[model samples]
Target: MMDFDVELIRRYAAENKIKFGRASSKAVIGKVIASMPEYKTRVRELIPVIERVVEEINSMSIEDLKRYYSPPVKKKVKEEFRLPPLPKAVEGMVSTRFAPNPDFVLHLGSLRPLILSYEYAKMYNGKFYIRFEDTDPKTKRPEPRFYEAIKRDVEWLGIKPDKYIYQSDRLELYYDVARTLIDRGYAYVCLCERDVFKKYVYNGLACPHRGQSIEDNHELFDKMLNRFFNEGEAVLRIKTDLNHPNPSVRDWPALRIIDTETYRHPRVYDEYIVWPLYNFSCAIDDYMMGITHVLRGAEHRVNEVKQSYIFRYMGWDPPEYIHHGRVAIPEGVLSKSKILKGIREGLYTGIDDPRLATLPALRRRGFHPKALYNVILKTGLSSSNTTIDFSMLAAENRKVIDREANRYYGVRNPKTVYIYLMDDVEVKIRVHPDHPERGYRIFRLYRGENYIYIDFEDEKYLEYGDLIMLISLGNFRVGEETLEFINNDV
Candidate 1:
């Protein structure tokens, strides 16, 4: 067996644990083999020695590892939340996707998934994707501009997706999957009335049409694709246990007919009538795109549970899920319908309205992407819902822009003040108080009468003989109608 320093291995493992939160034996062993020149010639015999070192590292307690790896001088560290550990299986091959409906622009709450997926993908040196879930062309009609707008929004956040996909372009793939499910007796066509079906679903009972033969279901499904059935006349639902606790999982509807003529799709107008719902299309895409991990809102937990039935019937392993809490802004609206209505009603501007919490609006308001990232990183992945007041966002944003934003003075409802100067004064004020290298604004007041403006409202607080400092200039005395200079001590 090749010999190695036991103490060195312990120290290295401790440091690795500090960095990765878990001591990886493979990494530790590889590091040892690379560092020791003797192992180059005896690589085959080093396994036993490496295994012994691995056991030693694994035996170290969390407290011992932290104490061993900590810096000598204690300092207060930032108490920021971090993403929980990723599954070991997704280490190098991690792939994540952000699916956005192109009906509207992305909001602050939408950034949670985009940031998490992109960050996690980057953390593992993996791939990130931007998939437009614009399959619903009727109820959630997608605008042509929003596709590009959403892309620009993600790019503005400094996240460039490795791939871009549109569900409309992949209709045939979804159709084939749906057909396969129907043929395998795992899905059926439900022609029952919409309201009646809902009533049946609520009671954890299957509709009468759920017992349709696979052959009949396949024929009806083709008719659905062929546009023979009108909207709401029929729907395709996946097979699940009738007595399942969650009524949503009891043979949930997968595909439904939509009248594309009225609410036409921008990409593929009137091309298809049968469109997949959120769960089915999303689950299929997640599997088809090789997504290893899914980071979405806790509101999608029901979707996850419902989609698991599809994955099980299709014999595909579902991706690991990380559901975070909802982020609400009390001062800003989150509803897309309400925002759009407000825009139409002339209550606000477009998507970049300052009152809105959209990514574009925040960008226009001088908020940096790093500040948003910091806020999201601190929030981490928790199922507990959170309400983010505007002040909280302002405080976070202030930290990012305060260092660079230039300073200026302004007076509202201004009135002129004449200063009778006894001497010339040169005033130099740094553009940014924290950064002098950015230069200053200079004001040269010559000996004579000089005029400056102050708010008209300030006259109420002033008295005739009172002395006042004209900030950056000098002190002056308030006269009966005009101001007189006292000294240039300012």
Candidate 2:
């Protein structure tokens, strides 16, 4: 309508300026037209009128622009991460662990738990440990090299684990716990077909073999441990409510026979046949290792609930669980499967590819560890998921790198510029303008053939009579294939 307020466009553009560092006129016009209910149907004709008003807004003086719109000034505050308190007293006896599967190197997502565990341990003056959960040798198989690679990544993050434990090395301990559970009438050895069990579970009924006696279940469990039962023939299920609302929590499978002869583990190749599932093994370790606190993503709350059953069965109190929302980089690939596939298909150079969000990639791209720590600490344990832009991370990194990284000029598509001069001149340029104490790099321009190469990037923006100043050198005006010195004043 002719009475539509046009000042709304400038107001919206100023709000966007705080977010994107600059207001886009096109974006402002589109937003203004979309905001009007009557102009929705006449977008084609309204666009030109809205665009013309936006143009006028863009040409306003900076001071006048500020009068219309400006971002609020935020007072700086010291960053202090607020994590939930541990359930029990931490009298320097607290122990925490970072259990990572060594299938691939650590990434940004992995660092979330790692940093939380490590920092909490240090905060309480307690011990920190690193545990490698490499039980799944078939699907997400672990590699031996990744064991050391993960250790290196943890150390690079400035975390030093007091103890390192491998799940493969503790297979015997899990077997002992499995035997205890079977003999205590808490677990049963399942020999039913996969489809048959699924039907029973779907109907909220226990399988026929769930009624087996403790002695009979013990025999089947021993048979499983000794490899008498084939991989798909048997599994050990924890006795839980079949009619539970959550089907996944209904009689969850604790251990299954993995035919290591076919898919061998890198650490203990073909040595064990029976393998414990995630909840069972993780719960058992938490109890055995005296872990006081567990920090993980909210996605694993199901695991926490399942592990509670294990703790109840064993007559032990489970550790405190702290769950935070998941995080992702808006521009980088954080998925492990995608990262591996990209490297295999030549879509990425490796895990260290700048396009990926792995620790190695960020390290290669000149990101300081403290900068990443700052971002994560600021996020804290918020329940909402975070999808931060890559520019935000880069801005944080620039603050740290700016103080240390040396300056260097890279010429792109260079073109020769001849300066007709009578005498040679030596120009002294500081290595870093702000850091003059570092030293100077001297450049000598020849007397007879006074010529230098300028990047085409800078050349393309200049006109025949445009005056510019080269760093540490005097101002000069662009001439026909030559630079005419205008003034040598400092």
Candidate 3:
């Protein structure tokens, strides 16, 4: 042990470049004295406790010897944690917009898609905007009350958009896009009447305007536009691939002039006669808003391809697309337009009628937002059409409401009961049996009381001198029965 301690101290001193004052032979004798069992035990156990004192005495300067013996202590500075970088395409984050035409109140079909789009945007941590696509003046009813009601219903369902956009504010932009397409020879003004246009358009057949140059077509377009504005005439059609298999693909109308007083720009009606179609407007808006993902109902699946063609023609990258299934109503439920007619004709109340699947009606019937979310989640994010049982939704609602709703007892029909208890005896009845923590309600019982209220059904089963139990109170004996009351005198 003595020899081992001396060797350890000598090695540490050498490694640390510490110079002992004594020569090697004298140092060995001094080390022998210092490494005795008693001395070794004292130093080994106590040195760690006095390390700071030893460091101070030694004045440990490693600057000169660092390279030779002592290595520098590498200081570890604390660093702030950072998340991994996002893709460049989404670094600024993508934006999604839910554009609902405010021509009528939003029904279950609309709400289903809105919820889906909103949730999908949130999942990707993107911004969501709500745009009122009130472009068609003919369809746009001049009613602020309907708009206010729709907004209120959306808010009640907890879906508030980060930004609100209106198509009516961007009519000029749509016109500009239409003009660009016409100048680029991708669109031409059609002289054909509505029926002729529909036959060629719906059948995917080529129109006579397909081979005409914009210079040649513009003259005819101007004549049509002038007559349409001043005399009321024809429309402009987009020149797409006529050979495309989908009937919706052939020479589709990009613009049309509608003579309606409902146009917000009635004064500018003469300045621009042509109006952009739904697909054109959608393509322009999506590109301008920098939307990366377009989530919509499957009914618009074919429209997605049409919009993609428009984007391709304009040299813009179309947004990523996902089309979900539409919510179908049962046969008896009227179409939205018919429902509006019914409301106007006093067939039903306003849009939130309980029989309808509007958000307000579901809320009024005590359905929780969680239950609605659950229904959507259970439905899954697929394009397959599914009809969910209404009773299934109702059962889910009852589970949530049952825990929080207060209980009360009311008899539909009643008869009088007379009770005779000892004078000043008290009876206590609890409002809820399983919930005793809610406390109890008291009833006073007086001796020879003439009459009290009981259910009429309770009287038919009771006989003379029969003891009947009150739900939460002691039993009483029935003494007699009259037309008005059951007399108990026990």
Model 2 is weakest, by summed lDDT over 10 consecutive residues, at: 15-24
Cα lDDT for residue 245, candidate 3: 79
**Candidate 2 per-residue lDDT over residues 1-490, each given as its tens digit:** 3655767766776655433333456577656755665666776776666666655654554466777776668665654667666668476978899999999898888877898788889878998899999999998899988998998888887888999998888888988888888878889989999989999998999899999999999898889988899988999999888887888888899999898999999989999999989999999999899998998999999888888888998899888888889887778898888988899999999989998888999899878987888777777767789766566677678766776776877666788888765567789877776788998889888665487778664566567876656656667778877887766654
The candidate that achieves the highest TM-score relative to the unseen native structure:
2
Q: What lDDT is obtained when candidate 2 is compared to the true structure? A: 0.81
Estimated TM-score for each candidate: 0.76, 0.79, 0.67
**Native-vs-model 3 lDDT?**
0.62
lDDT of 3 by residue, 1-490 (tens): 3224534443343333234211132233334434453554465543442333223323434343333344337564533222222223363376677887766666556656677667666766887888777666655533555567678877877886888777666877876777677789888877676677678777767667677887876776666555444323556777777778786677777677765443544324434445567888888999998877776788897788778767977899888776777666563253677777878999869776777776666676667776676576566556788665455576557655555555676765787666655555565655555566777777765554545676665456566655444544444556665222133221
What is the clash count of model 3? 2
Among these predicted structures, which one has the highest lDDT?
1
How are the candidates ranked when ordered by lDDT, highest leading?
1, 2, 3
Task: Quantify all predictions' global Cα lDDT against the true fold.
Answer: 0.82, 0.81, 0.62
C-alpha root-mean-square deviation, candidate 1 = 19.0
Give the per-residue lDDT digits (tens) of candidate 1, residues 1-490. 3355766677777766555434556677767765674665675676666666656655665677765566557464654556777775466799999999999899889878899888889888899999999999888888989998998888888988999999999889989999899889999999999789889988877789888899999999999989899999999999888888877778888999999998789999998888999999999999999999999998888898899988998999999998889998889887888988999999978889988898888888878887888788878787888777666677778767876689988877888877787778889998998789999999888788888887665555567776666666766678987788777665
lDDT of 3 at 111: 59
